[model samples]
Target: MNILIVFNHPYEGSFCNSLLNSVQNGLKMASHSIDLIHLDKEEFNPVMSAQDLKAFRDRKPVDSQVISYQQRLEKADHLIFIFPIWWELMPALMKGFIDRVIFPGLAYDYANKSNTRMKPLLKRIKGVTVITTMNTPGFIYRWFFGNAIQRALIRGTFWKLGYKNRKWISYNRVKMVNQSKREEWLVKLEKQFSKF
Candidate 1:
């Protein structure tokens, strides 16, 4: 399987980087080829300009990098997103990648005559998995904050785009977790994805 991992984090010392490594190691154990898109390292432009918006309306990608990302996605069988939730949402770069690359006529299209429904065009994709780390407690985030990350990424994005097989693994209160606990989580992640 070709797993496309879209990772968003500027700090190399962050735990998210460790999570990325853990997931990659698991995928390697499973003999799945990995394609990583480090958004910050690539210096991806998050803000959509006027021209970009115009191109978006036309269902066309104007940015060279976005086009390349689309090509990479086209070859992927499974998609993985690794990021840290900030302000109850993903970083702007990952959001922008979705806004630019996962556009109409490429990743999806209107399925009905009324244009009220969408059909996913990424038929090669079997599923999507999102891994996130956050400072807020999981219970609070889910009950109080309404799991905004899942709402935006899983339900709001992929499900609405007609990709039904979606999963999310969120590590909440990451800063409070002890080193041993974090290592355990990493081990579990590696074991889990090794079968993926």
Candidate 2:
């Protein structure tokens, strides 16, 4: 399997970065090819320019970066997103990456709009996994936002884009994570990626 790992953590020394390392090693041991993209290191502009937006919606050509990432997305068989939750949602950079990379014609087509049937562009991808952590508790998140990050990453986007067998592995209240719990989560993630 060709796996594309998208990382959004700003710090190279963070827990999310450590998680990425574990995921990469696990996937490699499972004989899967890995392509890692650290968003902060890349020159990705979150702001969609006026002319670019107009051209994109008008069926005209946009920047080459968008086209390039779209190609990566098309070729990926398994997609892994690594990020941390801020205010119960994805970071602005990751959200903006989705907006720019998952374009209209590339990710889906609006021409076939109807009441029922919707088109899916990423149907080729077999699995989508999200590895995220947060400072808040799971109970607090459930009571307030009801798994907003999971819904947005797994259901709202990937599922709609046709990535099957979606999975979410999140550790909440990271500020209180003990060494034992962290080790346990690392082992759990390794197991998950082995099956991927």
Candidate 3:
């Protein structure tokens, strides 16, 4: 299986980075080809500019970087996103990637030129898996904050685009956890993806 991993974190020593490593190792063990998009290393521009907005309005991407991402998306049979939750939501880079690359004519389009209807263009993708790490407790983020990440990533994006088989794995209160606990989570994550 061809997999595209979109990852981002400012610190190399962060738990999110370690989780990314575990995921890659497991995928390698399964003999799946991997293409990684490390947003921080690439210095991805998160702000959408006027030209970008124009291209978006035209239903075509003119930005070179977004175009490159679209090319990678075309080859991915499965999509995996690994990032940390900041401010109770996905970081700016991940959100920008979606705003720029996963636009109309790339991820979806108007169905029969209807304003309210959409047709997904990513037929090659079978499923989406998101792995997120955060300091906030799970219950608070879910019950109190209303799970903004899932609502945005799943319901607002992929699910609405007509893609099914969505899965989300979140590690909450990671900073407060002990080293042993973190290591156990990594081991479990690796074993899970080894069968993917």
Candidate 4:
């Protein structure tokens, strides 16, 4: 299987980075091909400029970078997103990557000129896993906020695009966890990715 990891975090020493490493190691152990999109290191432009919007509306290509990212998406059988949740949502970099790369003619198509519905274009994507870290307690994020990231990415986006096998694993209270607990989380993540 080809797995593409979209990692969004600024600090290299952060827990999110560790999780990214664990995922890569696990996938490697399983002998799956791996690719990474490190948003910060890549200096991805989070802003969708006027020209980008115009080109999207015109059904024309945006730019080489976005095109390259879309091509990666096309080749991947599975996608894993690693990021820290802020304000109960994805970071701007990941969100912008979605907005820019998963544009019309790539991720979906209007059912017809009437545009009453959409048909998914990403037929190659078979599975999606989102791994997130949050400072908020798990109960609060799950019950109070209703897992906003899951709803946004899994239900709103991927489900709408016709992908059904989706999973969300979140590590909450990350700042309060001890080293042992963090290590345990990494072990668990490795096991999970091995199965993927």
Clashes of each: 0, 0, 0, 0
Give candidate 1 regions above 4 Å deviation: none
Output the TM-score of candidate 3. Answer: 0.97
What would the per-residue lDDT of candidate 1 be over residues 63-114, giving only the tens digit for each residue? 8998899899999999999999999999999898888889788899998889
RMSD of each: 0.8, 2.0, 0.9, 1.2
Q: How far is candidate 4 from the true structure (C-alpha RMSD, Å)?
A: 1.2
Ranking by TM-score: 1, 3, 4, 2
lDDT of 3 by residue, 79-170 (tens): 99999999999999999998888988888888875568777898999999999999999999999999998999977888888888999999
Model 3 Cα shift for residue 55 (angstroms): 0.4
Stretches > 4 Å off in candidate 3 = none
- What would the per-residue lDDT of candidate 4 be over residues 1-196, giving only the tens digit for each residue? 9898999999999999999999998999899999999999999998999999998898676688898998998999999999999999999999998888888888789887997677778788888899999999999998999979878998888877777799889999999989999999999989877876
List model 2 lDDT by residue over 62-107, tens digit each. 8777677777888888889999999889998899888777776677
User: Candidate 2 deviates by what RMSD?
Assistant: 2.0
lDDT of each: 0.93, 0.81, 0.92, 0.90
TM-score of 4: 0.95
What is the alpha-carbon lDDT of model 4 when measured against the actual structure?
0.90
